[model samples]
Target: MTLKQDTTSITTSISNPTLLAKVDQLRDLNIGQHVPLPQLVVVGDQSSGKSSLLESLSGVPFPKDQNLCTRHATQITSRRDKDECVHVRIIPGPRASEDHKKQVEAFQTKVSSASEFRDKFVDILKKANEKMGLRTDLSSGHGGAIFSEDVLKIEVHGPREDYLTIIDVPGIFRTTVHGTTKDDMVMVKNLVKRYIRDDRTIILAVLPSNVDIATQEILELAEEYDKNGKRTLGVLTKPDLVMEPTMRASVCDLVMGQKRPLTLGYFLVQNRSSDDGVKTVSELDQGLRIQPWSDLPKDRVGILALKEQLQSLLLDITRREFPKLVQDVASQIRQCTVELNKLGPSRQDEREQRSFLSRMAGIFQDRARAGLAADYNAHSSFNQTDLRLITHVVNLTDVFNADFQRLAHSRHFSSLEESQPLESPEPSDAGDRSESQSGLSVDTLRVLLEESGVDKISPKEQMELAEILVLPKDIPMPNEGFTDWIKEVYLQFRGLELGTFNPNLLSVAFTEQSRKWGDMTRIYMSRIIVTVHRFIAATLRSICPEEPTRIQLWAEILEGLLDCYRKAMAQADMLIQVQQRKQPYTLNRQFAADLSKSRGHRITALLRPKAKEDRRFAEPQYMVNLDDIAEAAEGKHNTELLQEEIHDILHAYYNLALDRYIDNIFQLAVDHSLLHGPDSPLKVFTQDWVLNLEARQLEDIAGETISEKKRRSRLSKKITDLHNALKILKSRDSY
Candidate 1:
């Protein structure tokens, strides 16, 4: 089945305006420097009429020779204009910028005459090869040579030109030639791959009809980059070379998508060979009208059809990609702006330096205040909850208090009555007799006897007989063994006595338990300090305009602030340690209340009746002596009450201390060290102090290097181009 021809429609399609003009505007702004742009990348094997096809489409006679035609990528951009002119230039690869600059100075020019354009074009390419260090000497014995990935750009403007831009890359080769090495073959293939790999690119895979499509490396490479073949268009160049009927039929099958179909399909074009001389568009058109061509579909052959198809494809792609391209440019602009801000300003003198430092100081001060106030919104770096240093301190305080309270109630500090046996069944009669005989003066024995009777006597009775009866031995007399034993038992019950306060065993337990507070708080404080340090560094870099001054001042400020932070943290830790030492202060009224409550609960639990299952009789009654049980329960209840009081006091004090420690951290570590002006390390940035720095030091600190200047220039250019590209896109009604 032969495809029908539409010669008039094809001609009209070629003349229609395309979105290539918009694409050219994007290229002109060099948006590709930051992001890939929509393009048509032409790729094929060596001597596949790639140059001829490009020359025909562009109407520019590109140099054709084994070594001169295509070494690096040559971008040919043509547009319709009233004036007829040609402009040529080179966009150097990253590593070859200097050579490119030199070449531009020597070879960049404009031409109006076709002959002059051709002659000057070849000269520029040869010079570009030299500048790019691409060796032209094939005769050199050493066949290995490197090729450059640089591009030579040519632009043409004329009334007859279509608004289009296409990239013609070095043709792929199987083996090394004079100036080209096996590496060069790889380099060219890689270059082609880079272009085709871009989703926005429309790949034109050129191949001569004489060569087997299987042997064409570019077709395989294109397939590799565009596996679905959605954007790949096969251009079977040198269609005139297929003389045999069988071969023609095969070519027809390829074009008609019968063999190895591409999504975009194929077009057969009769491109002018080297011996065909410089043929005009009219002559090429006239030639295609001949015998075999007349029998073929008009839309499937000739440059007009190829141009129309390319324009249509490029426009479709551009429309699809334009919005994204705008968004990308805007994103890049923001990124570059951020980077430039980080690099800081190029301060020319002391005044600017002082102003810059002052501004940075102000920003730092504001952020520090925000941190202290726990205002997360004021600074993006601070998290809403934990990252705010004050909030973190508060959280830590809660944890510390909870831990302290837990320790106070732990079994380690439980009352001796609950934790140990009540007594050793009062000493044996033999032991008691031995003690009584061993050593007690009459008076001491009498006093002990009186103390033993005290519980039997009422408090009123003891007060009434105070003068007649000798006072019980509050102080033990010498040679009194019984009195000594009484004192020892009293001391054991008291745990350890410090002054008037009998510091509960809970204190000792807590000291050991909370020892990690110092180290933990230290680690926590260190993180806060580091966070503030990084913030200061980043803030200084962004706000300060002078690079040299920013570096020097940042170092000095960081050192001083960290030193102040260290001192403040030490002070806060000292408070924590002091609180730790005085732990378990159980002097609060709440302690008494809690202790009473606990005692009541314990007594109630003891008095409560047992379950019916535990009893053998249907009616359960007092099997044991109620009086003896009540007396024992009373003693145990008193012991538990005392222990509970002590633990309650300790917990109350721990809570108070934790609260005080948190306040101290905020007051000392955060407020004084970071937020306070005169005492803060950040005070060094005061306008007077910065302005008073020696001129020589300022110069040394703020000096800009050549590389820095170059970087700034490049960034500035990129930002401007991005902004321009964005403007262009925004102005378009379709966008």
Candidate 2:
């Protein structure tokens, strides 16, 4: 293949002598094996003349039998050579065995004439079916289905052949046939879709002109994969069969780009019917030049026109996709290499197994350390928020302590002194006392009688008695004593009413407020455990890359580790619960001492004697001595002191309990569960434990399954193929 080289641009034309050669070079590179390559993919419903179109283009007689022809993908590469020859081979699918692939490719038959080529191709198909174990008959209903999605590659070189490569896939069917099921139909559609889905592929959606265009499944399928119709070309076959005038008009509309116009437009070609027998390209062309066939546009009515259109389309697509194709292959090579490296070197023997185990242990140990330390940045999988497991537990504990305090100081346990009523002012006059308001003395009665003239008294006697018994007109109302006011204030300050002083009340309130702490503790601990478990499982999968080992680690080993961690956390929670139930205790004595000092000062202020000048005239002139007042004052003071002491004690114990509970949770739940040596979850991956595993245990952990080996082999082969493809593309200096 040669090209009219230009550094700045690529101008492709079907008239260019070397254009087809360039495309043939691409096909020879097997670029399709690694990445999507530019090509023509023929798609149509059953018996839509797809095979005839291909045969007309390549000048080869493809099998015409419906059952045997085009059962699998047929890739034909045609090139011009002085010596005419045809070669056939099979490229097995990824699942096919090496022996089967060789056997299929080994069958070779060359033909010089179109008739010989037709017979040889049919024989090749029959031999391939038998060798590949594909069942062609379904009447007996005892074997596997007939068709496969593998490709049958044919390379033809002749002096008159145009250099081109085209793929022919199985015709799409709507329902099952004798040998086909619903699954077979689905398989055929998927196979066709896989090819047409590639952006690099130019789809030739063939339909018989007699059939409704809407009824052809290939057109719908093509539209789905090529919505813009940019890469799709409609090919209407059997146009000679459409005898009706309306059908001819519709065909003309489709061909003239009027009805459901595609970007590349449509081509109408008439192929020889099945009963017409084999004919040469010269005969077909001469026949097309006669009568009504010659009336249509010469460019749209012949196989020669269709071939030239396809050649131009293929060249244009190849030029457009060439640069992108190179980049895609290079990128795939890098990605596949990285993935293969990650799978690590194969472990086949004892020493290799030991090395693999050591590597896994190291990975597990490092991840475990990072998780326990809450160092989320150590791994890409963890984020800052996920690393706050311990901090969350600590915050939960703080909330619990605050709730306990709130309950302890609630209104139900408030001191009575804080709620006591204040003392009311004593009555200032006799009228102010309800009991003394109606009392009448003899002097009042005598005064009334004298005013009424009931009796007469001497002036001297009246004066002397008035001086002795009459009160001063300006006398001050009787005032309350300082001692009485002090006693009233003391009574109000006394703590605790009747039922509030019960110790059981404090216990009940504490219990009710702190009940959620246990549940919260368990939940927080469980969260931490789950986080660690996930971290370890993810780490194991990354390190080992084996499903069996991952399953075993989680089900057998890691589960036990989680159970142990759970039990430890539960025990720590139990300890906390027990401590909470104990009567609140504390070693702090400063609060009690401060309360005692405050009480002493209040007592001194109450008992101080009143000064002589400070005494009121209506109050007693001498010191008032009331034993009951002193006793009551002393009793109220004692009660206040006792209540203050109890409050101080409980407050101190609440703080101490919080400190101890926090310590216990950190030790048992966080540290013992994950960070503890020897008993820690990380211990499962220690070198000593892994190295000491028995043969059966080691096999269970690191052994490979037959399917896994095959998968790896396939991956390795694909990577190698990609590398080889990249080398070939890169070898072209212009690229």
Candidate 3:
């Protein structure tokens, strides 16, 4: 056959070049670097005739030898144009440094004829391999970098070419032989898998008919990714070598889909080896027309039929994926644009740096204001707990108040009798304390007589009570039992010729009752400090685009935020000091009411006449009758009444002081000084603060660093290229 007829026999006809060219354009823009694009990828075992297949399909003679193997991924793209031309270039990997990328991209060549391409291809491959840090010799060890992920891109344009693009990756191999190490074997396998694993890629599984298909690693990987064989097309190569009937029938069964069935089925093709003289397509077709191959389907044979199938399949895939490709490109464009915006414009000089700082400060203030006001609708960040300033403040204050009510007292009184030790308190007996309400009531003062079932007392109190209870009964139990410990104090401090004890006793008892105020409030203040720090960080991250910038700004203002927090803590400490003043005093009406009610309860319980022995055994009872209270008031137990009076007064004053102190801490220290007022930590990054900064300080906080500028430039270029890609997809005209 003549050369024209031979070329025409292998040429793939294209009905819709526009769709394929759009795909080729997207691949040219390197859109696949950011996202996976639809295309055909050739994968197989080492020396499996993958290069021979590419040569047949592209009509370009590739350098071939028995020991030669594909060293890196090669992307071959062919498009229809007026003149026949070839262009080769290197597309750097993602991890390549900027300088290395420039050096790699600088390697480019152009050829005007097929003969020139064939003559120069081997030398070009050798150069590309050496540039990738590998020796050209397949069995020689010369470099540390054994394998690469970079791609060698070749663009072919000619009047007779079909619009097609195929990515050929390094073949999978089992043994680490020759120049290959174990890591190199694994790397090649991983590289092939990465390309074929993309759903948009159509896998061309090349299998040699001379070898068992099951043993080939490429088919296993193809099945692994394309489980149903939906996107995979099987290509049987070296069919001329299967001479035996049994072996030929096995290959034919695969070709006819009788064994290991695939959705796209299989095709058989004969590739010319290096030892074979210049052979025509007619000779290749005649070889496939023999007995076992002729019995197989006609559509699944020869190089021309395989080319036609590949082109049609690729067109279908490109058409189906075009809209999605456009959408992905647009989405990535928006993302890159947003990243560029976050980096903001160049901030080289102090004025520009100050301007950038001012803008950041404005954003910080807006977010901080919204967070402090609980206006969650203002910013999405306010919904986060660490950034919800007001909500955390309220929750923390409520928790602090509850902790004081439950834990502030050194000892607690229990109403349960010794026999009913584990029973829960009656609902009516539970106290309802709040920030504005007193926590103590008559139920809180029900001191246990036997002391066995008393709740909330420490181990120390229990030990002391045990010692007191063990005292001899003949030793005047009135001043000996646990109940009269306070009476002993009153007696010791009594003034001359008076029924009342000295007022100093009240101050001393009250001071001891609220003694934990300092440590507890300090802990509470520390918690608030943490909340402030978190809020500031969350707000800054939401406002700043880069991590380094956020870190620098944090360093600039971290000390100030802490200083404001410390000042607020000092103010809170002042409130605690007020609770420890020389005299216990309060004007709250509730204190007097609580005191009177407790006194009446104590007096009535002490003076009631004893019940009958059987009735007392049936149920525990307390004296609550008005007549009993009046009778108790008329009795003469001066020391007992005086002790009970002192206890009641101390409890009432404690409850009143606790309520007011919690309010003071929240309003004066937390709200006024730390969060919202003039000393607010959020105000540390204001516009005025930026204006006051020195030139060096401004640059340190806001100036863009070398890496940041490089990142910005990269993103800008990516966005511009993606936009251009989108336009290419939208264009309706043919090239």
Candidate 4:
């Protein structure tokens, strides 16, 4: 059997050894044989011992230490053209600047000056290392080091005939993400987040035996992958460096325990010099030959023992745990697709339901965030942004609907066209979205919604489908600038005045963050995740029947969603109060009525009264003062007083915005509570509360005017109050 195309597969051989034994001749050169698998990704922090552990796992030695020890992400696939089937083939991680051809240039340029790799690559790379602030494994030169990058592919054939693909990431230690600016932490965060988020990926943290516990940086990095039960394994690499197994065990326990999502497994491994097949340094002869670990002492001989333990653990994880994950992905794909199809172009009821639920979820989340942040004026901005974002996001459904339309129009399709309907829906890459038939998100929604109804899709299905949607990548960068506004307001509360540069408070100035979720939304990012939770519940229900996964899982999910919604409601409620504060009595009563009304019923009703309120509350000198305020100087006429006056004018604007932020958060919290219970806080709001807030605000502002001196005095009082408020919050639990 050829490595590239063999009837033998890693799993197939494990379950059926007859195939593996038949290929023992191992001397045939063929390319068209083998069931191929995707390359495995081994990721972790640098010097986490990834290299040594990978070699040990694969039972193939290539290079050691920091010596060319994965300077680039490498893909270890298979190549069977050789007489002997190669076990693994490596393709280095693609660099974005690959086309620059810097490494290739240096290779060719200096190599022309000399024939030896040592004379060219090693020497040039050494100097380049210094310039790049990178480390070089310059000892014997070409051991595990890499310099050229026309895609350095490495092939290794193992004794066990396990032809599996593997990916070796560049050492995270030296891999400092280069950023162009101070606030460019976004780019670094994005890169790190990407590496950690790929659900298909597994994290392999390799550390020296001396690394008794992971540092906060590494732990935090690892936590990014912890959610969704991503498999993270800790390897005490260079166990040869540490003399005791007990020490290795202790380190693994401490590090793994401290990490968020518990690691899949742990290993103590070492790489002996020269010859490779992953035996302990003590097990190998000076020439580096593999040896069966005999009755050797545990201390010196245990690297081999450690290797055995890791292999056993890996075997169990692959055979048992990993398959369940794959199954979950499969189920989610089916469910999402089914639901989306129901809401497709033809299903008016489903589409309407989908639309309502989508709006419900959105408005709730928006209010929740605003309320949580105490940003009263955020309501309007959120509504405007929501209008804009949804306009674009819902448009994507049209894209999905259009496709479903074609399918129904053409084939009267009962199933999506594919090799296996069970396959996980593939997401579209940023550059090539058309390639994937439907995103797992799109498919899950369509399928599930379609299936839920008898002759038509059920309302529950529509909501579930919409809920399962993959967040659209194309929503024009939402008013992340609002985050800056939040920071500004926070600064103002701290006596930093209205305009200030405050970094500590503005964590991630872009408000493109997902809403603070209830447990449900948090777990439902992938349509697949929902599917898994359902599958577990469904399958288990067959045996132990009453454990409703939906109600159980969703109960928690709902609580969080409601928390978000309540926050939003409170915010919107506050903003109406602010508007009322400035309005005349009759207008204030109208504002109260509108605030109490359901947000969607007839926004016009809410707006008419509020617009009248704004009119009545309008300062007699509003426009002229605004123009004067806009034209205010930066001269030495007591800038503070001028600023204070400007601040008052802006406060009106700010207060309006604060309402929106708070409302959004409240809504988000409410979204989580949907499935919690009938009496869930997520239950719709009454008009009374909104009106009450308006009345209270009107009373509060009875003597409060937006004049220069009044504005200054109010600012002083509010600032002091806010300081104490923040202190209480901090002392409570540091939300």
Which one wins on lDDT? 3
Q: How does model 1 fare in lDDT?
A: 0.63
Candidate 3 vs. truth: CA RMSD? 11.6
Tens digit of per-residue lDDT, candidate 1, span 387-494: 354544344334333333332221222222433332222222222233222244333443442343322434643443233223222221112132233234335657
Better of 2 and 4 by lDDT: 2
TM-score per candidate, in order? 0.58, 0.57, 0.64, 0.29
* lDDT by residue (tens digit), candidate 2, 158-212: 6655567888998888877766788888888988998899889999999898999
Tens-digit lDDT track of model 4 for 1-735:
000112222332234222222222110111001111112346656556565555544433434444445454344433222234322112212231434434333322222111132223344434443333233544433333233222333343333344344556554443323212322233334444545454444555555666555452544666666654355655455544555667645654543454333545454445543443434334432221222222223422334444443334434444443344334434443554454333222212333323333443455545534533445466444333222222222323333333322221111111112232312222323222232234445545444434432123235534654444333232221122322344355546454544443332222221112122221122222222232223222322222222332243244344344353344334433433443243212223434444333222222222332232335555632222334433434332443433332333232323233334333422432222221233333333212222333433322322122452343443343344333332332242311
Expressed as tens digits, the lDDT of each residue in 175-215 for candidate 3 is 88776789888888888888988888999999999998889
Of models 1 and 2, which has the larger lDDT? 1
Q: State which candidate, 2 or 3, has the greater lDDT.
A: 3
lDDT of 4 at 170: 55
Predicted model with the maximum TM-score: 3
Give candidate 3's error at residue 666 in angstroms: 12
